[model samples]
Target: MSAAPELRRNSLDLPEAVEAARAQYAARRPRSAALHAGALEVLAGGNTRTVIAYEPFPAAMVRGEDCRLWDLDDHAYLDLCGEYTAGLFGHSEPRIHDALHAVLRRGINFASVGPGEEKLARLICGRFPSIERVRFTNSGTEANLMALTAARAFTGRAKIMAFRGGYHGGVLTFPITGASLATLPLPFVMADYNDNDSAAAVARANAADLAVILVEPMQGSGGCIPARPDFLATLRALADETGAVLIFDEVMTSRHSAGGVQARLGITPDMTTLGKYIAGGMSFGAFGGRADIMALFGGKLPHAGTFNNNVLSMAAGGVAMGEIFTAEVAEALYQRGEALRARLNAVGAAAGVPLSFTGIGSMLTAQFRIPAPDRPYVPTPGEEQLRELFFFDMLEAGIYLARRGMVALSLPVADADLDRFVAAVADFAENRAELLRADGVTG
Candidate 1:
């Protein structure tokens, strides 16, 4: 799903260097340029998804193999973007790939329940601490919608308490940039992330009507900013006090551990929403927690979708959870990510740029901010320019990550390839030192 975020914006002008880089970007991707031009006739702005709409046009990739991708221009890339954390097993995982093929052999559109669905559901319920009884959805967006609906149905309330920069799904985004027109019309008590006092205040004010408090353990599109432990604890406490269903949006963060961030932090939520890498890269999402809360479905609060338990996704996701991404592999990949992030941060420091990598485990993002951020977004003047420049620079060196600087390391990404990524990052930090040190840029 290329799954580029509909995250950031552009209002201020970029530096001349960025303009030059953009030109270089156009020069290198002639085939992509023509494809995009042709595509514009049918697709909106050469994209159906909003996130793929980036400055200097997004590259048109033809195919991918284990940790690598080939673009329309024939440029090869080390895929650090990891399909926005959805490609955890990499492009060609034998087990997951085999599962999909096997499903096709069995045929599709089975009108009744399939064996694969029950097996996959058991695996998911076993893995997540919050999910005692689970239900499937086609995407994370759908899972999050159902989660909120369940919360409302269970609590008989109307409002949602979420963070300023939280992103539950396409329709559930509440960016620090501003209100998105596509956001769901559900009442929101938006609170600042990592600010326990303020978040507590807002939660209490809406406690009477707040049915759910949905949040990401890390703000994936909001620059991978993690929620402070105490901030989450405060929310947990507030939910207990207010009778709200605390929903952890682990769509991206679920890849962090075998049980996810809730296990990492040792804080359990009343409900959990999951997607991204969970389905072995097939379109998948699940919502579940506490058996009593999930009983909404049994009470016949309808949750329907034909593909909710499609054998392809269920089979592939079962392979992903039960076979490929086991507890040991999850731990090792996490260590690899920590080491990589540390090295990247060291490179930025040595080059004297206010750049750092943020997020936990194999999923992280490159952030151009001072002293790092505990909040959702700070929105400094030149932050967007720096992010764009860094993106083009990475592309020129054949390392592909999200334009917003998000990186989600996949299981197949080799250590040597990681070393090369670090070297490329060091090169970028060295080359962009002056621009980064410029007063308004990193401030």
Candidate 2:
């Protein structure tokens, strides 16, 4: 007997699936929709941060406690995004709260230099191996900008070497071809990330004019791809050979280890830019390195910001680094992240799907692809649709993550929460097995 009419392996149309998901998301977040509508009257596209904006609008989170976030519609989710790695301490950490409270009670801002700034600077210099004379900025963007300025001033060169897909803040993003429209116009030499020969060629081509070779130890926004150690070492050697300053954009990767990615890789960049959780969830950024280079601001070049040494950020950052994120604590967190990623990968393998996670330490990006032996690192075309579907699915499962499938583990994230997230991922893979299989995704 012939099999009753062959069944369709992938019956779901991607467009239709996306539409249905958007509709479901909208239906579940009426309050968020209303808020977005209200915000449109004031903010452009009803959003200020482009990264957080998504189709059919985004959720308006109301409050967060520990690793949980409550959105406008009162939906609670495990905050795996971790405020894009800014909330490493998570929301409402008792220590951070108490520290900020004390700051508020004593003073909010002081026009003059304060003891808090010096204390925080000392703490940072001690923790980060490369930093010797740290200077604070209001945001990572500011910190990166200042770092580049220092590099240019020191080298007396105008050209910079940056990698494609490396983000150095809002104004310093370099995509595949050129800098983003909003990025500051600079003489940039773009090179392929993690490609040693490409980077060396670029650096050598502009050696005379190369002021700084800026890079992230791990590309946080570029799918959380970590740079190969050999590649970083090559960049280091190139910087030395060309007399170009090397700047490590450790704003995101700093959370990975006590001494940051540079320390982990045993490659000391001339300068390191920091931000995110360094201020204990407050507004913060810092750039510092070799004493001679950082000394530019002392007399040679002027760097000033009204809030550069804001009392609250300095106090919170000092406590967070000195007390909360000690070496032992960071090591434990890194180990936990390693265990979680291994389990997540195992889940994908058992499902026989070409799903993989890329990242180092407490950060990861879940990627879906059609299996191709020759192009293993290449993502499948239109795989973003699958990622969007996964985002909606995970959100529905009470797990929240970056729409791009990025996750940053917070200190408050419990072992049970990680297990739950992995289980959720397994469910997604199994439930969508037919679609994945039809997409040529294989073991």
Candidate 3:
């Protein structure tokens, strides 16, 4: 019952590692320090996204091209974070850049349908048979809003069922019940992910009021847990039995396959929401499903946004999707992702870190296990310390992955980039874990 062996490498010593990482960051961004000081004067958290803010301060990135990003102080690093999987086509990809530039010249928001909308919509529907019609939005959050509205309209019910740890964009009503969104309530009921029986039981119990069951085919924010196929099939059956809309939020998983997780699984949901890679990093989202369900927006339910299908996003999304999504391209991404996952597993095993990964194609997550059952899987008092150490270590090592340990591979990422990432993991295993142990985070 003594403290278990250290899980990571010597690089993760809590107190020492945090200080070292901050020192390294300060060394690289003298300008960023000044910028943060100035930003804090105006910005509430000195940053827009709360998650991106970290101790000391977050570096302000000035430019990004392809797989690399540069800070205000001119520090360049490989961008493995990809804006949290939104940049699947890479930063400022040529096709997207060109399309965006051209479209911007014409206009940005017309608040009217443009030619690009029809083209992009056609592409989205063509890939996923379940998406017979679609409505565009500016971000994933808006897409979920529309999807939920449609579900409520179609089912004539009030409650939505979401899997625990499943993320369907930030809807205050839906509140992220599982991993992060454990606060809010849509008259929501949480069921264990990858556990179909529990989920089915919840649906049965809540059948009368369940409007829809929203899930991520692969949970990106919730530790990148893959939704078990059987669980999805069972959920589909339950939804059908209870007359609830089955909505799969494929924002993170769309890059994996043309039609997304629904298409990859060869199962159709009554509705689907897509974002992230859809616009090739410029910011776009869409919700589509059966024609009748989607058509609810036309008159029955209201779904309107002046910038929903802005010309630039549509143009960039159309060009990027057309170029990147093909049988050959998808297969190549699959193979590359498998290689990356295998390398990470090897690193974890050697480091004595119980790391597990689940996903298909380019999207994946690395879950670091803690000895405490409620540690990694459920948030414990010390969980924040462990996560902070892991991220600080990884960031110091020059691999810019999320603190939560999610990785999104771009089609542009080649052998060298992949090798660099794997090597970083190995270094962490060999050097970072000791740092974590020294911080009193052992086991």
Q: Cα RMSD to native, each candidate? A: 4.4, 4.2, 4.5
TM-score of each: 0.95, 0.95, 0.90
Q: Which lDDT tens digits does candidate 1 get at residues 300-388? A: 59988989998888899888998889999998998998898888888887888888888787878887865767677666657778888
Q: Give me the candidate number with maximum TM-score.
A: 1
Candidate 2 Cα outliers beyond 4 Å, as residue runs: 1-10, 370-381, 440-443
Task: Give all candidates' CA lDDT scores.
Answer: 0.86, 0.85, 0.73
Q: Tell me the spans in candidate 1 whose CA falls farther than 4 Å from its real position.
A: 1-14, 439-443
Please give, for residues 277-384, the per-residue lDDT of candidate 3 as tens digits: 787777788989999987777787877677787787888878877776665787678778977877777777667754445556676776555331221155443445
Q: Mind giving the per-residue lDDT tens digits that candidate 2 earns over 90-198?
A: 9988988898899899877669999889999999899888898999999999999999999999999999999888888888887654548988888988888888889
Candidates, ranked, TM-score: 1, 2, 3
Error of 1 at 383 (Å): 1.6
Model 3: number of clashes?
21
| Candidate 3 Cα errors over 4 Å, as ranges | 1-13, 172-185, 370-376, 379-383, 435-443
